[model samples]
Target: MTTYPPNIAKLFEPRPRLKYLEHIDIAPKERSTPAVSGLSGYLAQLKSYDSEIQYTPTEGPIQKQQRERRERQRVQQAKVASDLARWNPSEDPQIQGDPFKTLFVGRLDYEVTELELQKKFAGFGPIERVRIVRDQRGKSRGYAFLIFNSEYDCRNAYKESNGMKINERELVTDIERGRTIKHWQPRRLGGGLGGRHYTKTRVWGGRTNTFGGPSGPRSVHQTRTAPRFGTRPAYSLRLGPTERRPYERQASNERPERDPRYGGKYGVYEKYKDVKTEAPYKYESRDSRDFRDRDARVPERREREPARDKKEDRTTRFDRSMY
Candidate 1:
C-alpha cells in the first residue's frame, strides 16, 4: 500500500454527503387525490376528448367489435348472394372499372406510331407516357395505352377522341379497365350448321353434337342413345348409307324398275340412237313420172291412129254395095 498526504487521501476516499436538501422530506410521500381540475389535467382531458370523439366509442368495446364483425360478415354474405344470382357461366369474365389514370386507345391503324399517339393526346393534356401494346413479334395489338398527368386529362381524352377518324380508321377510346368482353358469341354446342337452337341431336361425320344443353363436343363413342333426325318420325331402316334415322322413307315398292332390255336406265335413248327420221316432203326419183318427178318440162304423149287400117279394104267394099 502506498502512503499519501491526508488531504490527498481525502480526494481519493469515498465522501459522505446528505441525500436530501435541507429540511426536505426524502421518504415515500402520503397518497393524495389526482388534480383533475389542474391545467395539466385539463390538457390531458382535452387530448382524451379528441380521442373520444375520434375513436373512444360510446358502446362497450367488445360489443362494438362484435357488431362491426357481424356487419362485415353480413355485407360479405350479401355480396356473395348477389354474385351468385347474377352469375352467368357462359359469359366471359369482364373488367368493369378503371383504377389507373390510363386511357385505352383502340381501332389504331398498324401504321400509327407512339409519337402520333402522344401528339394526338397531348392536345387534351400533358401525357405522362405512351405505350402501344405489342406482341412477341413486336407488332401492335391494335390498341395503345396513354397515361396522363391527371385523371381529368385522361377522361377528356377518352371523351374527345372517341370515334374520331384517323388514317381512315375510327378510334374506340375508353378508360383502360384491362380485359375486354365479346358481347355476341356463338353457343357452346351449336356453332354453325348444327347450333344449340336445334331441339334435337345432330350428327355429322360420325360425331354427334347436342344442341339442347351445355354438353359440348361429344363423339360417337360417348353417346348413350341414337340421335334423332330433324322433326320426323323414326324409320325402321335407313334409305341410304349416308342417311340417319327419323326421316320418312320414300315408297320403295311403288316406283317402277329400270328397263333391262334398253340397256337398263338409259332405255329411253335406245329408239333415238340409230333411227333416221324422214323429212316432210317425199324424196323424188331420177325416173320421169307425173307427181314423182321434180323436172320442170311436161312429157309429150303419142296420138291415136285412125281406127282400122288392117280391115280398110273390106269395110270400103261393103259400104259401097249397101249404098
Candidate 2:
C-alpha cells in the first residue's frame, strides 16, 4: 500500500457535518425479543430453560430430570396455545347458546364429569347445557362452560356457585369472556383475572394467597350473594315475614315459590328442614334425664364448696403456714 497525494487523500477522507446545525442523535437499535408462534406459547413461560440445548449420550440424574421437565412444559404450553387458537369469541362453532346466559367455569377437576357438575350446581338454577373443555385426545383441560336458560339464572349461578367445592376442587365462575367482556382473553392467552399458579414470589389469586383475599366459599358467598341460590325475593324490614314478594324463578317451576321463613336472607332456604332436629321450643335432651344427673353422687348448681363458716375462718398470718 502506498500513501496517496494530499488532494486525493483529502477526497477519500469522509466529510463531517456540523453537529449544531444538521447532526441528529440516533437511538441505538433495541434488541428484538423472541417471537412465539404456532401452537407453542410455553416459550414465554420457561424461566430456567437453557438457550443452547446440548444433548449427551450418557445421562446423569439432574440432566434426565431437566430433560423431562422441559418436555413436560413444552407439551403443556402447546396444549394451552392450541386451546387459545381453537376457541374464537367472534365466530366459533363450539360455543353455542346466548353469550349472556353462558357461565365460564374454571379450575375444575378433570375427574368431575358433566353430570356431577350439573347435579351439584342444579340447586342454583336450571342448566341448559354443560360443556367440559377437552383436548384433541379427548382428555379434560380442567375447565367448563355452563349455559343457563335465562340470563338471570346464569348471573345467579356465577355469583352463588363460585368457590363451591365439587370433587374436592373449588370452582371459579365467570361470565362468557369472549363475547360478554370486551378485549378479554383466556388464561392460556395470558389475560385472565385470576390464576392458581400463585407462588411465594407471585400470588395472582388463590385460597391461601398472601394478598389476604377471600379464603373460601363461605367468605365469597356471604359477601356477594344472598343465602339462597335462586333469585332473591323483595322484602322490607317494615313488612311482615310473609309479606315479601315471591321468588320469580326462571327455573323449572312456572309459579314462583313464596318463602315464609321470618328473618334475613338465610330466612328463605331451610337447609335443615329434612334433618330430624330436636324441637326449638324444647330444651336439651339432658333435661329429660335430669333424675339420672341428680343421682350422679355429685352436687349441682355449681362446684362443691366448703361451708360458709369454714371459708370465713381464715388462719392468722403467723398460723397460715401451719394451716
What's every prediction's RMSD, in angstroms? 45.0, 29.2
User: Which stretches of candidate 2 lie above 4 Å from their native place?
Assistant: 1-87, 197-323
Off by over 4 Å in 1: 1-98, 179-323
Query: For each candidate, what TM-score against the reference?
Result: 0.27, 0.39
Q: Note the Cα lDDT for every prediction shown.
A: 0.61, 0.68
Tens-place lDDT per residue, model 2, 1-323, is 13987877887887898578643654457446679678566765553365456555899999999999999989988988887777777787888999999998888888988999889878878999999999999999989999988899888998998889987788889888789877778766767776743333322223334443434543332244344645443332222122344555566566566556533456544555446334422324532222323333333432333323323444442253244
Q: Which predicted model would earn the best lDDT?
A: 2
User: What is the lDDT, from 0 to 100, of the residue 239 in candidate 1?
Assistant: 25
Decoy 2 TM-score against native: 0.39
